[model samples]
Target: MYAAVVRSYQESPKFEAIDLPEPSGAHDAVVDVLAAGLHPRVRSQADGSHYASRGELPLVPGIDGVGRLPDGRTVYFAAPDTAFGSMAERTVIDVRLSVPLPEGADPVQIAAAMNPAMSSWVALRRRIAFRPGQSVLVLGATGNSGQMAVRIAKLLGAGRVIGAGRDPERLRALRAIGADETVSLAGDPETAARRVGEAAAEVDVVLDYLWGKPAELAMVPLLKRRSDRSRALTWIQIGSVAGPEAAVPSAALRSANFRLLGSGQGSVTTAGYMAELPALVDAIADGRLSVNAVPVPLADVADVWGTPAGAGQRIVFVPTRGAGA
Candidate 1:
């Protein structure tokens, strides 16, 4: 079958005919992949950078996608960790890991929204003791996941949502989606951070995507215990798009009542993800969630592999050229 093969960690995926993955057990089944997203996790895995990456040679580089089974049931699935994944024309998936989609669900939309939306949905719903009507601040809000976080927070009943990002235009656009307000990470870093700090005083939860300089700057001011320390702040670390290894002030940790947690993978069990995934998929299928899906043929994987998906645009790969339509 035609698949996105990544033989070397340094190079982009090469679309070619490759042997299909064999199901290991009766519980597994083969899926005809309809659409798959070029997620950041897939990129990191292909380049051997993600913590969970196997560095396995001649691997198919996709983490999760939407596919159809023999019974014509459309489903959303994730590849088993450390295995060639969902980027092929057909791949074997553990049926237990696949969530059946609602009838008439858009494959490209689900394929594009699933991974990115799951990041925040699970984080907001399961990771911490999230209460309805809590205030949320989404850092790195320009990205697709971050944008989803803004809406997901509101959907889950956040009292207010503030989006913070480097792009002024994207940040403002977030307001129309779900954010009650937006903060720009543009111009002088310190000034932008101070502005974010001013807004952070009332924020009860922070879904942080960019963890490098922005996190440190956001943390320095946020972690300072104000006159009334009654509001319990939860900082959920979702992704490190900017850079890893943030230099947080020791004083801030010592002085604040904030709880910090890293979500995804090891932090949340597969059972937890599966338990919540159906609801998420249902929401997308019901059109409760909005995603801008840019469907490209899997044949073009080589061309668009490395380019970043712009704000609000998710790159979805359809294995067959006509399926993308």
Candidate 2:
């Protein structure tokens, strides 16, 4: 089997031929790798920027993938904590972690969609109690998860959806997807905050992906406008694309009457994940939710990593020819 292995932290991944081993656990099933999503986290892992403080090395870094099982069943999975080995011809995953793919579903699309969709799903459903007709503000709207968040919020019946991002062109694309309004995240924090507040005078929910000084400043003013004293405004933090640390004013919480929630795959229980999987698939199949993906050969993975094409949409890595659509 040919696998891309990160020999060390902070080093570029190398593609090398390796021997394939059988599954060790009874719960594990070997999957013929069809497509793997190249995400920012994968690059972070390779470059020693993310989860690097933990010091795990010699890792095969990929969190989401779609593949076929020995029984010829197509499946996709959200394998976060476990060792990610999806950048190869074949890999093994726990059966509980795998979800059967719909018939005729594009492997590349499924591979690309699962991670971002799950992130959005988990954030909206588990982290925050998002109710129908509630207004939502999505930060980092051009990002894969951010775009998915906008779509998910609309699908879940958000009364108004506002998208904020630095790119003007991407913001236009965001409106086409689901966002009712788009705001450019330019200028200083105060100026950006004013623009966001003006776009939507009041918002019930905030899906924050960028956590930094700017994000903090922007959120402070927007959150301050929530009027429903009984219903707490939910602010779900899912990503740190801007920076890990944020400078938030403690006083803002007092005025907003908001509940700050942190969400990720880690926050979801196995039972909870199982319960939502069916509805998620139904939404996808019904065309209520859109999944955007870019398919690229595994050989070009390094090049894509070197460039910037791997940033916005889900970049699916097709390990074998004829596997992806």
Best by lDDT: 1
In candidate 2, stretches whose alpha carbon ends up further than 4 angstroms from where it belongs are 52-54, 227-231, 310-312, 321-325
The global C-alpha lDDT for each of the candidates, from Candidate 1 onward, is 0.86, 0.75
What is the lDDT for 22 in model 1?
69
Q: After superposition, how far is residue 158 of candidate 2 from its true place, in Å?
A: 1.0
User: Which one wins on TM-score?
Assistant: 1
How many clashes does each candidate structure show, in the order listed? 0, 0
Ten contiguous residues with the weakest lDDT in model 2: 50-59
Candidate 2 C-alpha lDDT tens digits along 182-242: 9988777679877886775577887888988657877666765546545567778888988
- Candidate 2: clashing pairs of residues: none
User: TM-score, each model?
Assistant: 0.96, 0.91
